[model samples]
Target: MTTYFTKDHEYLRVEGDTATVGITDYAQSQLGDVVFVELPAVGQSFKQGAEAAVVESVKAASDVYAPVSGEVVAVNDKLPDNPATINEDPEGAGWFMKIRLADKGELDKLMDEAAYKAMVG
Candidate 1:
């Protein structure tokens, strides 16, 4: 799987034509304790850079943008009841949704691990 990141701090773990979407650990840390997450419904389509989800924490409520155009295939149902999972494992189980990619080429616009690290640092 190849992982890509947006300047907004979203990450996409791509495998085949699908990608798992979530906030990076860096993002979660900045958000403080997560209080709520509003995810898009499955089958919902989003254009690249469009708001696909909402994440609210003790500090602020932030919009999670779609890194590339795609349709939501699934969402993490466990978040509403246990938002702390985002603080504990932001990139793993804390993932917000899965998307079926519309154009693989769109990923080329995002940052790789090295570039993202330097940017955030």
Candidate 2:
């Protein structure tokens, strides 16, 4: 899988035509103690850079944007009841959703791991 990141701090782990989406560790840390997550429904579509989800924490509510265009194939149902899962594992079980990519070219606009790390730093 190839992982890509947006300047907004979202990550997209691409494997074949599908990608798993989530916030980065830095993003969750900044959000502080996640309390709720609003995820898009399966089959729901979003264009690149569009709001795909919402994450709420003690600090504030934040929008999670799509790194690339796609249709939601799955969402993590465990989040609403246990939002801290994002704090504990942002890139693993904490993933927000899985999407079947709508436009592969959109991936070119995202940052690779090294670029993202440097950009965030």
Candidate 3:
């Protein structure tokens, strides 16, 4: 799997033609304790960098942007019931959705881990 990141702090783990998407560790830390998650519907389409979901924390609400254009295939329903899962496992069980890549070329526009870290800093 290859992981791509966005300036907005979202991460995308691509495997084959599908990509699993979620917020990064830095994002969860900045948001403090997550309290709610408004996930995009399965089958919804979005452009690269589009705000596809919303995350609400005890401190504030933030947008979860799409790292690459794609159609949402699935969502993590567990988040709405217990949003803190994001903080517990930002890159694992907390993944928000899976999307079918609309254009593989868009992946080139995203950052690698090191670049994303620098962007976050």
Q: What is the TM-score of each candidate against the true structure?
A: 0.98, 0.97, 0.95
List ranges where model 1 is wrong by over 4 Å.
none
Residue 48's lDDT within candidate 2 is 88
Please list the C-alpha lDDT of all candidates, in the order they appear. 0.95, 0.93, 0.91
Total clashing pairs for each candidate: 0, 0, 0
- Candidate 2 lDDT, 1-121, residue by residue in tens: 8999999999999999999999999999899999999999999999888998999998899999888888999999988788999999999989999999998988998899999999978
The pairs that clash in candidate 2 are: none
Q: Give the candidates in order of lDDT, highest first.
A: 1, 2, 3
State the weakest 10-residue window (summed lDDT) of model 3: 59-68
Best by lDDT: 1
Best by TM-score: 1
Q: Candidate 1 at residue 57, lDDT?
A: 95
Cα deviation of 117 in candidate 2 (Å)? 0.5
Query: Which parts of model 2 have CA positions greater than 4 angstroms off?
Result: none
